[model samples]
Target: MINIFKIAARNLLRYKRRTLLTSLLITVGVVMVILFSGLSGSFKQMMIGLITDATLAQMQIHKKGYVSSIDTSPLNLNLGPKAYGKVRDMLEKNPLVESYSPRIKLGAMLSNYKETTNIRLNAIKPDSEIKVCPALPDRITFRDRESGQGLINPGEIIIPDKLAKGLKIKQGDTVVLVAHNKEGSVNGLNFTVAGVIESVAGPQGKEGYIHIKDARDLLRIDKPEVTEVAIRTRDFNRIDMLYAEINSALAEYKNPKGNPMFEIHTWEALSPFYNIARMIDLMAMSMKIIMIAIVLISILNVMMMSVYERIREIGTIAAIGTAPGKIMGLFLAEGFSLGLISTLFANAIGVGAIYILNIHKITFSFGRTENLLLSPSVNFNELIWVSAIVLLVSIFATIQPAYKASKMEPVDALRHV
Candidate 1:
């Protein structure tokens, strides 16, 4: 084995420039695959985290039929107080349950005293969002730094900064929320502007925030009813288990409505932005496959040229009684050596590049909203997998040239030169 490798190394050194060119091809392929996989994978994770932590949380439980008719933001389809309490109790007792926040989703008219426009509002508890969504408060741009988590109080609300700028409203200003009750009766209430936050996910989902009490009062709901419960888990990967537990624990409280009092949805189901992220992941895998194809073609070209140039040498060794299998092994070793060396260099370069990018906080916009931070993750197992595939493909590429060299007729070998 040592002798075979030494012979292969000698042969490669004889054609140093060709060998370097082949190795460089393999190196480029490896580096491209690693960088694409890392960037795409990180983008998917970042979008998921943004959606879950900022808006969706890991999961949500809504009244039956509520999500189906979500566009209407129907007030009649609400989880009455009894059902809300039951769900909250079930969430509290479960080990998988981290933190949950009850929200009343409402569509209302907003008036800055001079201008009125349509807006969506989420009425919530002032402090319940602490563990549930710590990022939510961290992203509150226009709030006083010390105001802390959740809505400030009744008659105070949070709006998106872009919307606030357009409406020409600011902190401590007054905004009026006018909405219709289930009976179609129009009701109006005034709220002080508490804070402004940047919108994540997209422009369409930008909304205002208010205390639940004010939402009920403005909408004229005689009793406490919630539209949905946004929930967060300590580990988002356990969402499946949490979903099952929620359904199992709430089985006793079934409603005639198709929604059955409460139904939970994972973040993926709640947001559509994930579809774009998934497409990026598919593109990454496709690029890696393309890299393998490039490796096969480039190595085959180099080995074929090497075999043709060394015809006399192959004939001499065959005439002296070298086995055909050994001849094949020599070429295979050459190809393998090139691939192995390239793989090492590529991995090192890829790792360093990712480190530099993350340290510098490299960012690019995924779609419309700008300022998404680049967070490449190292998948060492994937790196190993890619290297193995490249090496194997490189060896396979040598088969035709190696076979031709091994089968050269000894008598015809000395004829040409």
Candidate 2:
């Protein structure tokens, strides 16, 4: 086996230019796959982190029909005091749940004395909200930084910066929020502007935050009713498993019709950005397929050329009693060596490129957020998988050419000038 590989290496070196070109092609393909996979994977993760950490959390639970009617912010669909108690208890007992925030979602009309506009509000307990969405506080601008105050206090609100700018409102300004209760009765309350919040989704997002107690008071809800529960888990990568477990646990709690009263969803289901993530994944897969095609074609073409150019040599070896399988193995070994060497160089170059990119710190904007950093990294498993695919494709590509050379008649080959 060693002698066979040594012979193969010598043969490849004899045609160094052709071998170099083939290896170069495969190396480029592998390198492209690695770099794209690393960069795009990093981008996807960063976007997901921004969305989840900013407001959405990794998972959420809502009344079964509430999400369908979410656009309306239906107060009637709220999880009542008793149901919320049950959910809170369940979450508290679950080790996987890092934190959970109960929010009272409301659609209200905001008036800055002279102007009135619609706004979506999430009323939350500041402490719990911060725990579930750690990035929530970072989004607040124009706050009393010296005081180290919470995101929102009772009788205070954090309006989106765009809304504040449009309304000519500033921090410490007074605003009126008018909303209707589940009973269809109108109520309004005065709130001090705590700060302006930077939009995460885009400029169109008009979500504002207020204290949960204030929301209950304005809506005249004596009982604790929550519109949704945003949850953060300890292991985000295993979120699907946690989602299933939570759903199964909640299944035991049914409504009068014996159907589950609650529904759980991951960040992907809650955010529209998931569509873009899917597109990125599709593009990554397409890149891998193209890499495969490049490796296969390049190896196949080079191996066929090798067999054609060395026909007389092959005939001489055949006449000297060299086994057909030995000749086939020689070609296969050459192809494998080419693939192995190219893959090694490609992995090294790809990793170095990724390292350099991280060192320089690539920054780009997503939606309204600016200067977000991209940290591209490829895992060991991904590198191994790519190498395996390239090597296997190279071997497969050489098989036909190898067989053709092995079957050449010694007499016929010697006759050819």
Candidate 3:
């Protein structure tokens, strides 16, 4: 076996140019696959982080009819006080739930002298808001001008930075908010702009936030029923478990219409952009597969031609009593050796490139949002999986050609030359 390997190594070295070209092709393919996989992984991480950390929690509980009727006024499928207590209690007891926050959302139109934009006014508790959305606390300063009170209070609102600019409104300015009450009556209120917030997910600078009490008073709901429950978990990957627990708790609550009126939705379900991200990932993977197939075919063709060219040499060795199995081993070893070397070189090059790009903050932006840039990073587990996949693909690509070379008849091969 050792002698056969040495002979195979020598043969490959004798054809250094051909061997180098084949190796380069394989190396290029492997490098591309690794680089693309790294990029895709990074994009997925950024999207998940943005959704989970900045916008949506892992799971949400909403009044059953809220989602379908979101276009309508602020009518709450109101989880009554009893239901709220029950659900909040259950969430606190659930080991999987890290924290949960109550939110009331109202659809209202924000109007200044020049422009009007429809906005979803999320009513949030300042303390609980920080736990659910880590990005919110640092985003803006809600304050009262006369009393110098900070943190959003009743009749104060925070508008997204982009929306604020478009409306030509600034802090301390007044804006008109029109929304429907639970009784389906339209009501208008004037609010002082407490601050301006920056958000990547909200309507291109069109959304606004206010205190829960303010939203409740504006909508004329005396009891202030919450429209949604945002839940944070110790591990977002356990979102299914958290959803199940919350749904079970809500099962006992019935709405004003005497219908079970609470629904649980995961972040992926609530955010349409998550679906788009998934589609982009699938497309990228498919493209990588196609590229690998093309490279594999090239490698196979090169090996086959190399084998035919060396037919006389192979036959001479076989005629000198080299067993068919040993002859087969030689060709297989050559293919394996080539694949191994190429994979090593490709991984080194790919990793180096990714490292450099990440360190330099190479970015691609979308629209005016800075967070839309691609982030490139790989965790240990992903690296292991990607390396294993590359090795398996390289080995698989060598099989058919190796088998063909292994089965050639010495007499027939020699006669052909």
Candidate 4:
């Protein structure tokens, strides 16, 4: 084995320019793949985080048929006190649940006294809401951000930035919200604008936040019911498992109509942005395919050229009793060496580039979210797999040419020119 590799190295060194050029090509391809993977992976993760942690929690539990008519914020489909108690008890006992927030969703008329417009409202307890959606407070633009205030207090509202601007509403401005209860009773309440939240791109519109107590008073709900329970899991990667577990647990709790009473959904099911995440993943796979093609073609061309140029050498070695298997080993070793050298250089450069990106604090905006810093990184396991793929493709590409060179027989009388 050692002798075969020694011969291979000598042969590759015989064609220094060609060997270097092929290695450079593979290196460039690998580097491009690594960098693209890092950037795309970071972007996809950041977008998912924004959609899940900033807007929709990792998962949600809603009364059956609630999401289908979620656009209307149907009061009749809410989880009654008994159902809410069951859900709360289950979540509180489940180790997977990091935090959960109960919200009362409703549509209300917002009036700055001069203008009135429709707005979707999510009334929630400040403490639990912050735990479930930690990014919510960062979206507030009404008060001095430096001031350490919670999301909202009783008699306070956090309006969307667009609605605030359109209504000429400012911080501490008083707004009136008029809403109707399930019994069709109309009621209104005055609230002070505590903060303004930037509109997040999702299945939400002109949305605002208010204290849950205010929602009950405005809607005149005598019973303690909740529209939905947004939940954050301790481990995001295990969300699907937890979702299934929760669904199984809730299966026995049925409505009077003999159907399941509650439905659990992951963030992907609740947001349209999941489609974009899928597209990013597809693009990353395409990039890997392109990298494989580059490695295969570059190694194949180099090995085939080596075989043709060294045909006389092959004939001489065979005539001197070198085994065909050893001859094949020599060529395979050359291809392996080329791939290894390129992969090492590519990983070094790729990691350095990622570090530089972090150092520079590259920032860009997605949708209306701003100042998002790009922290591109590749997992160590991913790096190892990429290297293995390049090496494997290198051997696969060299097989045909190596076999051809090894199968050569001692020429007739060694008379060829």
Candidate 5:
């Protein structure tokens, strides 16, 4: 084994130019794959944070038909007083339920003195909203509307930063909101802009949020009419089970016609962006496959050429009683050495590049929000996984070529130039 390895090392060194070129190709392909994987992984982490922590919770409950069509016409499964009371009671009783809040959503037109723009309005309970949507605490600023005071009432409104900029409205500007109430009545309410919010969702940054009570009064919803329910769970991974249980609970409740009216949905069901994240992951895998193919081709071509060039030398060694397995081991050792060197170089380059990018605070602009594109930063576990994959691909790529070289007839090889 030692002799075979020594011969292989000597042969590689003998053809310095070809060996270096092959190693360089492998190194380049490995580095590119690692870099792209790191970037893709970072983006995925960022998206997860934006969706799970910043925006959507583990599960959401909406009117039976609201998930399919978000029409301006009154919500079909409007959770009235009885339904709200019952659902809330059921959720509180469940051990999986960490917390939940009622949300009234509407599409409305907001008008300043000079301009009007469409907006999504969310009516939320102040304390409950803060728990479910933690980003709200950092995004909104409070200021009193009267006497230029720096404090605002709980009933005051908070508009998105994008809307505030587009409408030329500021902290004290009064905006008029026009929307259909729960009873299909058209109503208008003037609200003082107490603060501005920034959100990952582009439309969210143009939407306005107000206290649920204020919204109920403005929209003239005399009875309970929450459009949706936002739910948080003790464990996000157990969301499917929780959703099933909630559905079962809701099934126990019957409408006047004796049928279930409520539908349960997980955060993944409600958010289309999560599907986009999965697609991105698929794309990253495709890229890695392509990179491996390129590296494999380069390695195979180099090994084949090396075998052809060393035909006489291989035949001489075989004729002197070197075992066939030993001959194959020589080529495999060469391939392994090349892969090991390239892997090390690639990992170093990839880690250094990621560190520099993170240090510089490189960020990508996403819709109306600009945030750090990488989350969990550069993870060591990912690096180790990628490195292992690269090594396995390298070994597999050389198997056929090495086997072919080992099977060559000594007499024929010795006769060749």
Candidate 6:
């Protein structure tokens, strides 16, 4: 083994350019995986925080089939007072249920009389919303008074700053919201602009927040129907635990219609941006595959050339009684050395690149919100995993070429011109 490594080292030194070029293919591949993984992870976390912390809680309970058509914000699919009461009791009984809030989501037209635009209306209880999203009240920049807060009363609406400027409306202004209820009847509500705020994450542009009672009145829902219940737990990391507990408890329970009452969703399921996150992951995987292909092709070509060039050398060694296994090990060692050398240096560069990017606080916008920092993040385990994969690929790529060199006839190779 020692002799094989020495021979491999000497051979690599003999063809410095080929060795470096071959190693570079592996290096480039490792660097891409490292940097892309870090950036993708950071983006995923940011999107999750924006959704779970800013808007939807960690989990939500919605009527079955609600998620498939969540875009329409269906009024006909809702939790009636009886079902709502039962679900609330179930949540209250569970120890992991840190807090929960009910909300009514609707698509409506908000008009300042001069300018009119469509808006997503989120009807929430100010008190409960604060518990789930503490930053909700703080996001309100403009209010009727210095001490004003979130949806203090019905007939009061909160609009985003972008919406406020676009419609030329501000705090204390009056607006009309026109919406259609489940009964297919159009209804209108007049509201006083209580505040203008900014969204923390998920979707951009104009949205409105109103008191739940007002939503009920405007939609003519007298029986206390709720579109969904947003749920938060003690720890996000342990959300799966709570989710399992809730599911187990509710497994045997059914609605009066003998159907599944509700479906549980993590923030990922509720947010469309989660698909974007998954796509980013797929892109990283594709990049890694491309890197592998580059390394595989480059190493295979170099190793094959080495076999052809050293045909006489192989015959001379075999005639001197060196084992065929030893000959194959020599070429494999060269490939392994190339992978090991490139991976170490490439990973080092990748780590440095991520650190610098995070240090500079690079950022870009998604929809309407601003100042989304592009912070790259990585971990030690992933670094080691990438290295191991590269090394294994190096060995696999050289196998056929090394075996061919080992099988060369001593007489035939020695007679080559």
Between prediction 2 and prediction 5, the one with superior TM-score is 2
- Where does model 2 exceed 4 Å of error? 202-206
Error of 2 at 198 (Å): 1.6
Model 4 misplaced regions, further than 4 Å: 142-149, 412-416
Q: Which stretch of 10 consecutive residues in model 2 shows the poorest summed lDDT?
A: 198-207
Q: Give the distance in Å from residue 15's predicted Cα in candidate 4 to where it truly belongs.
A: 2.1
Which candidate's lDDT is highest?
2
lDDT of 2 by residue, 21-59 (tens): 988999999999999999999999888887888878888
Prediction 1 TM-score vs. true? 0.88
Using Cα atoms with residue i matched to residue i, what is each candidate's TM-score against the true structure?
Answer: 0.88, 0.94, 0.86, 0.94, 0.85, 0.83
Task: Kindly report which residue stretches of model 6 are placed more than 4 angstroms away from their true locations once superposed.
Answer: 1-7, 65-76, 93-98, 107-118, 130-156, 172-194, 199-206, 213-224, 233-251, 409-417
Error in Å for residue 254 of model 6: 2.7
The superposed Cα distance between candidate 4 and the true structure at residue 356, in angstroms, equals 2.5
Q: Candidate 3: TM-score?
A: 0.86
* Best of the two (1, 6) by TM-score: 1
Model 1, 97-183: lDDT tens digits are 878998888999999989998888888875775566667775566546364544468878888777799899999899988999889
Q: Candidate 2: global Cα-lDDT?
A: 0.90
Error of 2 at 371 (Å): 3.2
Poorly placed runs, candidate 3 (over 4 Å)? 1-9, 111-117, 138-155, 176-178, 185-190, 202-206, 248-260, 320-322, 379-383, 414-416
Tens-digit per-residue lDDT, 1-417, candidate 4: 787778778877889999889888888888888888889889888878877777788899999988888888999989999999999999998999999999999999999999999999999998998899888777777665455566788999999988888889999899999998999989999999998888867775248999999999999988888999999999998998899889999998988889998999898988888998898889878888999999999999999998887788888888899889888988999998889888999899888888888788889887766678888987678789899999999999999999998888768314435
Residues forming the 10-long window of minimal summed lDDT in candidate 6: 143-152
Q: On residues 98-118, what C-alpha lDDT tens digit does candidate 3 reach at each position? A: 888898877888888567888
| lDDT string, candidate 5, 279-343, tens digits | 97788788778868866887788788878788898899888988888788888888777777777
lDDT on C-alpha atoms for all candidate structures: 0.82, 0.90, 0.73, 0.88, 0.74, 0.83
Model 4 weakest lDDT span, ten residues long:
408-417
Screening candidate 3 with a backbone cut-off below 3 angstroms (N, C-alpha, C), the clashing residue pairs are: none
Best by TM-score: 4
